[model samples]
Target: MASAVKDSRSGYGTLLRTPGAWTFLLPGFLARQPFAMLTIGIVLLVQSTTGSYGTAGAVSATTGVAMALFAPQGGKLADRFGQRAVLLPGVLVHAAGVAALITLALAHAPLWALLAVAVPTGASTPQVGPMVRARWAARLGAGPLMPTAAAFESVTDEFTFVVGPVLATALCTGIHPAAGLVAEAALTLAGGLLFAAQKRSQPAVHRPGSGERPRVSALSVPGVRVLIVAFLGIGAVFGGMQVSLTAFTQHIGQPGINGVLYGIFAGGNMLAGIACGAITWKVGPRRRLLVAYGLLALATTPLWAVTAVPLLGAVGLVVGLCIAPALITGYTLVETLVPATARTEAFTWLTGAVALGQAAAATSAGQLADGFGPSTGFLVPLAGTALACTVLLALRAHLLPRRSAGGAEAAAGHLPAQVSAGAEDRERELARA
Candidate 1:
């Protein structure tokens, strides 16, 4: 047992020591927390204040759509200009939007006013988390540490989801919603700026040979298309999950219970992600990714059976078990499949797919919950997961990486100097793809 524990610790220790790894992971975690917090907080606060869940859902949906539409552009900017250049403007735009949200709420502005403000706020969304993940691909050269890095990113996402709502709920209810939004804005500013300050965190983009025209499209890549589908499916699940908590709360005749439920759901993802990161695996990446998706599908099934709020929260915790590992593995695969130059764009595409999924889910879930009832709305994600599973299976051949024949030679080639050369190769491949 002691030996096992030591082995586990040592494994994580190696990951922690990887150059530029911690720098990329930690700041993005901090930055992403506020994004999750503000999103949940604003929806709850608006719904509570205006006594109209529909309007709140609409605002949230709008945010999701805007995020989806603009994310690809954000990725392009990050790649072409630089992470710092792209990030600074995004931070400011997000901050400004949040300020508008706070002001409108405090001023008792009409619902339309809030919706209008939420659009730009979503557009100016930071690329910090996506950029950070891309940086890992550049730094680590994509292998064992890729899973660890992806797990780190997933856990951070889960952690934010867990804490964001709780903090937002407490602040909005305890103090003022405006105050909560302001605080979220501040964190975005600070975190985005801080994240940008780290020179090593920027993604390495290599310009191709003379007269080489820019790549026409990321969609041309078979791997990118597969990953995008997975992202969209997962995104739909995430968006539906958010709405489902509220649906569960309302169904239980205790609308306030969603905060607790969501917190539990996010909590499960956080713990599972951390544990997944700690484990060292010799299994092939394709097999690991398949298992992750399968677990996600299996874990989601029990969620529909939950009726009571407490039971709902408990079941959600169990459902969350597969989320982080699945996401981490998927992201790791994305890093392997996509080239370096298009890395940021690829990440953005991933984010956009998720945003589109989230938006679609939010709209559909909200309407279903408000019209037919919350129970059916809760089941939509289950169906979405089944769809996702089919997509994963169908796309498996293209999405999964092939086992390299060189074995030890391939493994050893992932060091620092190799990282630079690999990035250059990735750029050329991305251009061609």
Candidate 2:
């Protein structure tokens, strides 16, 4: 019985039992690395070619805005037109945008041209993380399996952040930035196409209720709104961390080794995510979230003290470990709170919040680093996390209908039960239709 209980908690065990799980999960991990490489490569290429950090930054900003603003619409389109219909067009558009950005950057076209091209690039890019999570939830119907899947997604994301920069830097510096962009375009097209091609990967179709439009905005939902704010804070912390790392590495006379150090940092996050999945069942969601955020704040403070390269790297790894579980817990909370009709959009909003926060932190921290030295970059994430903690703490009572997440006892009223009913009703109708 003890062995059976242990096996039940194993993420791989749960995944093995779920039919068609691999068809969806496999593409995400495989496709993400290439996609991340391309995305980072393009960003590096654009920034290098333009010779204007401001313009390059603006392009990123445009992309974030597009992603945040149009994410729900994109999700809605998926609901209305099927995953393939939404995904293929978005991929082609992204391919075209990358081509244009590369051409313009190579040709030394005006900065405005790049920004114009970039907005759509950002907007059209599918919500890869959210889509994957939603698909998993749709398949497994959420239990211990959901946390395991969340760990997988977080670890994959960490890996992408770790490797993509190195690949981008190597390709851009070794060959030409344009070569990197071209590679990115190809990967995006292939990954997007491949993901769309899998029949099991399609989002479950739902029957609409009376007075419900096929199209709806996630902004209209209260729980989604709070989650978005939380994600924004999270994004800010991440962006600040990236800028801080870049500046700190350069400051310590090892600008060249920043990528390698970042990889180590990412490795810690991956480890933390995997571990979190195994133990998350033991802690209630609220406590896990509170502890994660509190620890993240504490982890960040030591960077302000470390001066030596070895110490910095060690401190960074410790700090990075706090990120994944915090993120996973936050996402799980959203799943438990958001309405079925708005789940996709809510997830997108969370993604957008993070993107926006990252962009904001990057800009602010980069500027501060430029003026006051790289060490100043720590100020961004340090303050960002502090603010995030305060805000979350202040709003904890109302964030999600006062339910205890991951607790064995269900709340009297909560969104997860509603989602379950919706899924059941939709499944029945699909059989009939």
Q: For candidate 2, lDDT tens digit of each residue in 231-255?
A: 7777766666665665676567765
Candidate 2 stretches greater than 4 Å from native: 1-10, 50-55, 207-217, 247-255, 401-433
**For all candidates, what are the clash counts?**
0, 0
Candidate 2 — what's its lDDT? 0.66
Give the lowest summed-lDDT range of ten residues in model 1: 1-10
Q: What is the lDDT of every predicted structure here?
A: 0.71, 0.66
Evaluated with lDDT, which candidate comes out highest?
1
Per-residue lDDT of candidate 1, residues 61-180 (tens digit): 888889888888888877777888888878998999988887786677897898899899888888676887778777766455666777777887788888887777667666775556
**Residue pairs with clashing backbones, model 2:** none
Error of 2 at 66 (Å): 2.1
Candidate 2, residue 269: how far the Cα is off, in Å: 1.2
Reference-based TM-score of each model:
0.84, 0.84
- Looking at candidate 2, the ten consecutive residues that score lowest on lDDT are 1-10
Candidate 1 clashing pairs, residues 3+ apart or interchain: none
